[model samples]
Every structure is written in C-alpha cells, then in structure tokens.
Target: MTAPAVTVRTGMLDCIQANLALLADRWGEPLRHLALGAHLRFRPRPGPDGLPTVDPPPQTHIRQARALIGLVPRHVHHDLEPEALRALSRRTPVVYAVGDTHDMPWLPYAGRARMEHSFLVSGEAGEACVEDAYDNETAWGPARPGRWRLPWEQLPTARTAVEFTAPAAYRAPRPAVALDDPGPYVQAYAAHPDRLTALRRLTSETWLMARARHLHAAYREHRGESPDTHEHLRRWDRLTATAFIALRRAERGRPVPDSLLPDLAAALHADREVFAVRDEQTEPPDPT
Candidate 1:
C-alpha cells in the first residue's frame, strides 16, 4: 500500500487528517497510543515491490527538537521533553503513570521500563511519578500512588541530584485533557474538516509516544541524570508516524513510503499494544 505524502512545510500543517476522525472516535486509547509512540511514524519501509530499509536508527535517539517537529508538524516545542512537561503540571502533584495490555480505556503512562521508589520525585509542592510496566499494556490513568516504580538502577539515591531540565521542543505533548475528548477547544474547532483530521492523527500518535517517554524521563529524573534530547523518542515517533501515514495512504489507494515495511515490522510492542498497526507485517488480525 502507499503512504501519505508528509511534506513538512512551515505552518499550514493542516491539509488532510482522517486520523483525527478515527482518533476522536476512539480518543482515550488512541491518545495514549500517540503518547506512547504507537502508529505515529510518518515513514515506513516499502512493501515487497517498493520498500524502504529501517534499522530503528542508532541507540540513544535523543529527539532533536527540530526533527521531532518535522515528524508530526505540530506546535508543541516546549512540552516534548520531560522537564518542560513537568513545568506544565507544576500544580499536578503526583502524576500517576501506569500501563497494561488489556487495552484499558485509560493509562497514565506507556513504555517497556519501570520506575523505582528511589526515583519518586517531588517538586516544591507536587510530585511527578512515572510507571513503565514491561509486558503490560493498558490505557487508563490518574494513577493511584505506589502503583508502579522505576528500576533500582535508574533511580538516584540523592534527592538533591534531581534537577529541572530545560524545556525541549522535541518531546510529546502532555495530555491536553484528562479524558479522551479534546476538551472544549477541540470540540469547538473540529468543524474545520481538513485541519481537524490532521490534528486528530497528530494527537493520537503524539499522546502515545509521550506516554512511553514519560516512563524513561521519570527514570532519568529519578537517577538525577540529564536527558540528552531523548533520541529514541524521535525515532519511535518517526516509525509510528511513517506507519500512520502509510496506512492512510493505502486507504486512499496510494503508494507506501520506502520505510513502511521495515519500520512497520520494528514497531515496539508497547507502542503497538494500544494503537495496533494494521499492515502485512503484523500477524493476521484475529477474526473474532
């Protein structure tokens, strides 16, 4: 199948966004999937006839602020990184992050890592906690405290070591609304079909990848380690974005991107747990 053409032009990013329609329909899970970097990549490997090779890029894929913006063409420069996100919720003391595979309707966070108690961090008045459950995938949040922890190795023994990071323009946007709905603004502005569609897809993929990154960022914050742009976050979002664009292209009878095949196959399990990418690479969907 063909992938949608994702030309990154400055501003005027909204043209076609069926993904938004689908996401808005199934907002909650899809939103978390986006935060977790599910099917958001814009360039997938090519199919047998026309495929692109993808190797998940090198490890430590710190999302360059510029690259990530290119991937989704959104306006979330500051909220993409951990430190910047924490600042947004300075009053959201104790952000509960958790995940599972039951396809839970609400999940605070998503990833294949864990958070240790040592990493449980507290700001002047509030606390930011991340829960990355391995082999677990659920979509629900407002997590209960102590529901999860980071691995011991990733946590910092000293609270003083924790430091606020510069706001990054290369991370996922935090949950704009507690529930799936895009709140008042989304509902208000959705009538603009073309733009509405684009935002929906962008929202779904963005939300999922962020959910996953939150886990890792929390660990780094706990360990008092500085995050180096989260390279993995960019690659992750790229892969899913590719798949999403390709999926849309195919639905419209278009040509898939060169990387559609390889990247589609490489999608992380946590990313796929919620927004399952429907393509030839995945096992045949159960016909229940």
Candidate 2:
C-alpha cells in the first residue's frame, strides 16, 4: 500500500510534546498555551541504593494541559494488531509508545539498544507513516526528527497508542493566555525540605525544567513581550547544568563543595526577584 505524504516540524523538547504539536498543527489548533504554567512537581521514590530518586511527574500533567487547550488524549493499553492500527490511522494519527526503540529503524537507537519511546504514526494499508520530532542527544546517539514509512509487519511492536479527540465545543486556534508568575515555582524548588534529594533529581530531570523555561520563552516571544524573557532561558540552562555537574561529581565519589546547594538557592532567589520586578512593571495602574 502507498503511504500518504505528510509534513512535520521539530521544536518541542520531547516526543510527547512534539507529537501533540503535530496533532495541533494538523487540526489547525494553537499550542503555545502548553508552554504556560511552567513549573516542576518533585516526587521522589526510593532508588536501588535506598536513597530517594526523583522521577518526572506523571502523565496527568500532560492530560490537564491538553484539556486546557481543548484536546483530550485517549490511551489504549491493549496492543492492536497491525491491520487494526492501519485502519485506525486512516482516521487520525496515532501517538504510539513502543517498548523497545531498537525495533524502530528511523530512530538512532535502532540496532543499538532497547529504550521505551513514543512517536506519531499515520497512513494506512501498505506502510505505516511515522513522524518523530524529538531531535536530541540520547544514550545511543543524536535522535533526529524525520518522517518515514514502516512495513506492516514491523508496526505491531507498539505497546500502546494515544488518539486525541475534541469535545463538542472544540475550537481551532486557541489564544495564548497570560503567563503564570514564576516566583512561586522558583521558591518551591529552592525551599524543598530534602535539598540533597532534590538536587539529585534535578540532575536527571533538568531537561524537563529547561524545556518548561524554553516554552515560557516561546510564549513570551509569541506575545511580543520583552526580549528579557529569553535571558531566563539561559539562566535555567546554567542552573540545571551546574546541578547536573555537581551531582555527577558526587556520584563519582569526588569532593563537591559545600556551597553548591547554597549557590543554587541564591540563584533561585535572584530569579524570583527578576520575576517580581517584571510583574510589577507589567501590572496595570490601580483604578480609583
């Protein structure tokens, strides 16, 4: 079967956001709102060494964000036969989560190692069209974004599929809302009870925080806000990188300076100060 032509763009920081962006683009919807409310929720779990390790927030965050933008994702757990998937693709694109990336020829991980990943699938009949916009450094190599066709025999490797549906009041092109204040979020991170565990989690999940900052920056750009917002992006990158390096050194049993956490807290305080000033400047005059 011949696959239909498709075009995809890469800008999001991860596969989930990228696929959602693709779906929004295809449906003529606005996605800048996903960048709103950029904050992190720290939920630490016991690691193999009995120390608390941080895990990225659950899928509920994605669902809530999507709902705000008028998209609802339905996740189907039972694996669907290749033929059934093809039929479903004929209707809408599928966001597939595969157990092993090694089976996906288009990914850098193919033939190198097994890693759970997600990408968009569409088209029907002969070959399944796959679109992945996650272009980043991975354990295997740099994963580049592109579109390709997978033979029906190879499509069944997907463990779950997510399809998006709109409500009865669905509207295209939702307007970008006001940016949430960043002061509270910065304070929360700085004042966490378990500073060591928080820093360790930040080491691995820094990308998540960095991406949120990127998104917020994008939203500010879209609204023609002050270019100063971009400065926050760089600050977040530096903050995350510093934490990552410190944690790596500790993990290697190297001497880490005692001032590391205090420095991070000071940086967070500075961020809160900047945001507070920006908020004050953007605030409207009181109407007496």
Candidate 3:
C-alpha cells in the first residue's frame, strides 16, 4: 500500500513561507524585510560606462536563505542526515536544503551538479515521505509511492538543514510584515565577529562597485525580452543588488550614508512593487 503524501506548497519564496506557516497556527516572530530588494539582494553598482550593473555570486540564494532563516524559529541542525529525517514529527515538517536534482520540474536549477535546493520531509508509519512544492506534480521515485524519496547519494552537500518542532503548549505570536528599520537586523548579524569578518570580505569596496555594474547590465539585457521569464530575472537582479548593499553597509557600520539611504529605500520599494504586480499577474483569477 502507498503511504499518503504530506502537504506540499510551492513558489520560490512561498515554499519557505508556507512551511513556516505550517509550523504554527501562526508564527510568533515577524518576517523582516530590510527590503524585499534586500531579501532579493539588489545591488546597484556602476559600470565602465557608469551605468548600474548587476551580477550575483553563485551562492546568493543560499546566502539569502541563510540570512532570512533568522526570522523563523530557533530549532535547527546541520547535515545530520537520516537521524534528522527519523526525528521529524507528523505534526511539524522538517525543511531540508540539498544539492540540485533533475527530478523536480519547477526548478530551472534542477539539472545543475551542485548543492542548491530545499524541500520538506515527514514520516508515516516508519516510512519517510518527501514533500516538495516544486515537485508537486512530478511523480517519481518515492513520490511515485505517494511519499517523498530523495536521492540518497546527494545528501552530503546539504546545508542549513532544519527541523521544526515545538512543545505542545507553545504557540508563537503573529509575524510582522516588515521591520521598522533594517539596522537592527544588520547590527545583530554584524555583531557576530566571525560573520562580520565574512561580510567584510564579501563586501569589499571594489567588489561591490563592480557588482552594481554587473547587476544593471544583466537587468537591461533581460528586461522586456520574455514575458514569462523577464520579470523573474529582473527580480533576481534587484534582489542581488539589495544583498550587496546591505552587506556593504553592515561592513561599513550600520548606518548607510544619508545621501544614499533614500535611493536605497526607493529601490527597495520598487522591487516590492514589481513583485506584487508580477505575483498578481500570475495568480489565478478569482471566481467572484
């Protein structure tokens, strides 16, 4: 007999959001947005021609995922393996970050030979099941059996692996839509001496300036070119730029220069607005 599949939600960011929501009737902590741009990591550097350019390092998504996970609950563990899988509760799902897979339909990165994906896992009657938003419609392997079965050989590269479990009596407060100021978020992250060192290295003056140029160039190349994919690329460029700026400011000290703050804020707002519009466009029309 086939094991029943667990609930799986998809959408790039919604995958994370839905999992967090599943963890509680409602989460206690607010999801912080230094800017949706910041979450996306939009860096506006100037090019040789003095135009804003955009380019993000390969690990941008992983880095952003790491930073954003701060908003969720504290229960987390690293590449601990089948032990982590065995420990998942039917009531709470465990989110796993792993290497790429050719099996998932929604991920363009699916065929890549590197670590860059995530999904949830649960168990029913001693049989483990994988629940993934991206693979919701794709039936293969364990998913064929109505339970999630991941490629066991690829597990080693997984990082930021976490399981969400709370005491029966524990309940969290509602999450905030946005933080009043992103300074505290930056400050807290930078306060960690080791992380601070890492951020400084990643946000060097020359690197950031070049990153800005790359981002703008990439955005221009893709803008308005393809209706289905153009906006996603645009969003990626914007997010990459935001990540660069946020890190650069954190490295320089929390307060961004006054002259630069308004522009950054505006860019951030623009990123959010575009995303809202794009999401609305893709959403299924209401029956009413």
Candidate 4:
C-alpha cells in the first residue's frame, strides 16, 4: 500500500527557508518575517572548486529566525538510516542536505554532477515522499519542482538532516521588528573592496540574497506599502542576472566589462533612494 502523500506549497528561493516556510504554514504561523533584516555582506570562503565563494549569514541567523515562529531546528549528521529518517518524517517534514545530488533521481543534477543541495521529505511510511520546490537556473539546467517517491532501499544517506520540532508548550511568536532601512546594506555592498570577486561569488550564491529581497518585498506588501519594495525586487533580479552573465563571460576567457560592478552598485543606490523617499512620505507629522 502507498503511504499518504502530504501536500506542501512551493516556497521561496532559499531551500531551507522554503521548507521552513512550509512547516510554519502547516503549524498556522506567520513566516513573512523569516528574512527580515536580510542584508548583503561579503563573507568569502573557499568553495568546492577551490575558488573563493560568498558565504551566507552565520547559522545563528537561521536559528534566530526559526525561534521567531516557535520552532526549534535540530541538525543531525550521522546515523541517517532510512528507518530513522522515516520516523523523523512521521513527526515533522525533514530537510535533508544531500551532499551529492547525483544519487537523487528527482534533482536536475542526478546522474550528471555532484552538487550539494537540500529538499523536503514530507512522508515516509511505505516510501519517502519527496517534495523539491527549488526552481532555478543552474549550470546543470533549470531545476523545476518535483514530487517523487524514493523507495526505502534507494533513500540516499544525507550529509545532514534538519528536523524542526515544536515544543510541548507552544511559545508565542516574538513581535517582529519592521526593518525598513536599506541604506546601510546597500552601502556595504557598494563599498566592498573586492567587488569583482564578490560578484563572481554571487554567481553561485545569489539564491540566498535573492530570497532575502523577495521576503522583504512580501513583508512590505503585507503592510500595504510596497510600491518601492517592488522596485527593490526588480533591481535585485537584474543584479543577479548581470552577475551570472559576467561569470559566464569570464569562464569563456572573455573580458568582463570594467563597468559591471559600478553599474550594479549605482542601481542598488537608486533602489535605496526610492526606499528613503518612501519612508519620508510615510512618516507621521511631528506632534510636538
């Protein structure tokens, strides 16, 4: 007999955030604040290809974000047997960080390359019901949403599995602070000493940054003040595309234009200006 399939809506660009959002939705909690205060910073690290890469914010950020919704994430690195995973799934959807995507048949990189990736497993009685909602362009190809079942024998071992569990006594969500200022973040990005390298790193790390922008936009829209927020989203989308194009050109030994970083920075500054103007317009008249 087939296990009952769980229905989960597609989430944001960040895989972990996407799964967390789904879980938050399941628990009837708010998640628009998950990416609040998301900002751009140049944290460089060596990637698998032995080249410098941009690192996302520290794990503390994720933990803090989860705590806002009264959920705690436990990360397990070893003893990921199928039965163990199945038991975890019985309690909550599991987010698995697959070190090598080549073994996961549902991923675009399956049988083609090894890419570290994450996806959600929603059910696992007879078989593991997998839901991968990551739809983005990658070196392999465009990865689309996929819902498939992995038999118990074929469930690949995960490098780490994150399980979000609710405490017996539900904790009230903390009041969310409105992070309306974008000036500092934009300034930091503009002032990066090694922008060309930063842009190169962004080619692979755009998902998280883009996810942050998307969430901020959603939060603004929720507050019914999103005119400038939409522009911020558009500017970020352009930056992501431009960075990818630059990376591809450099890969072919073509000269990456010198104006690339300056031009992108200018666009971000323009976005900041829009936000500044909006804030002024919305501010209450001084009541002194």
Q: Model-by-model lDDT, in order?
A: 0.30, 0.54, 0.37, 0.54
What is the per-residue lDDT of model 4 for residues 109-158, given as tens digits with 9 covering 90 to 100? 78887655666675746788876656666687776666678885566666
List runs of model 4 lying over 4 Å from the truth.
Answer: 1-11, 29-54, 74-84, 87-99, 112-115, 122-125, 167-200, 267-288
For model 1, the superposed segments whose C-alpha errors exceed 4 Å read: 1-210, 227-229, 264-288
On lDDT, who's better, 3 or 4?
4
The C-alpha TM-scores of every prediction are 0.23, 0.64, 0.35, 0.67
Model 2 residue runs over 4 Å out of place are 1-12, 29-58, 74-77, 81-84, 90-103, 110-116, 166-201, 243-260, 263-288
Candidate 4 matches the true fold with a TM-score of: 0.67
Worst 10 residues of 4 by lDDT: 279-288
Against the true structure, candidate 2 reaches a TM-score of 0.64
- List, in order, the clash count of every candidate structure: 67, 1, 29, 0
Candidate 3 residue-wise lDDT, 1-288, digit = tens: 234433322222222333332333223223221111222233333322222333332234333322333333345555545555455444454554443455343344445433244555656556555654332222122222133454443333334455443433422211112212334323333354564443433333224322333332332232332223355445445544554666667677785433233443443454334433232223311111
How many times do residue backbones clash in model 1? 67
Candidate 4, pairs of clashing residues: none
Candidate 2 differs from the real structure by a C-alpha RMSD in angstroms, to one decimal, of 7.3
- As a whole number from 0 to 100, the lDDT of residue 150 in candidate 3 is 46
lDDT accuracy of residue 222 in candidate 3: 28
Candidate 1 lDDT by residue in tens digits, 103-134:
22112342432222111123332333332222
How should the candidates be ordered by lDDT, best one leading?
A: 2, 4, 3, 1
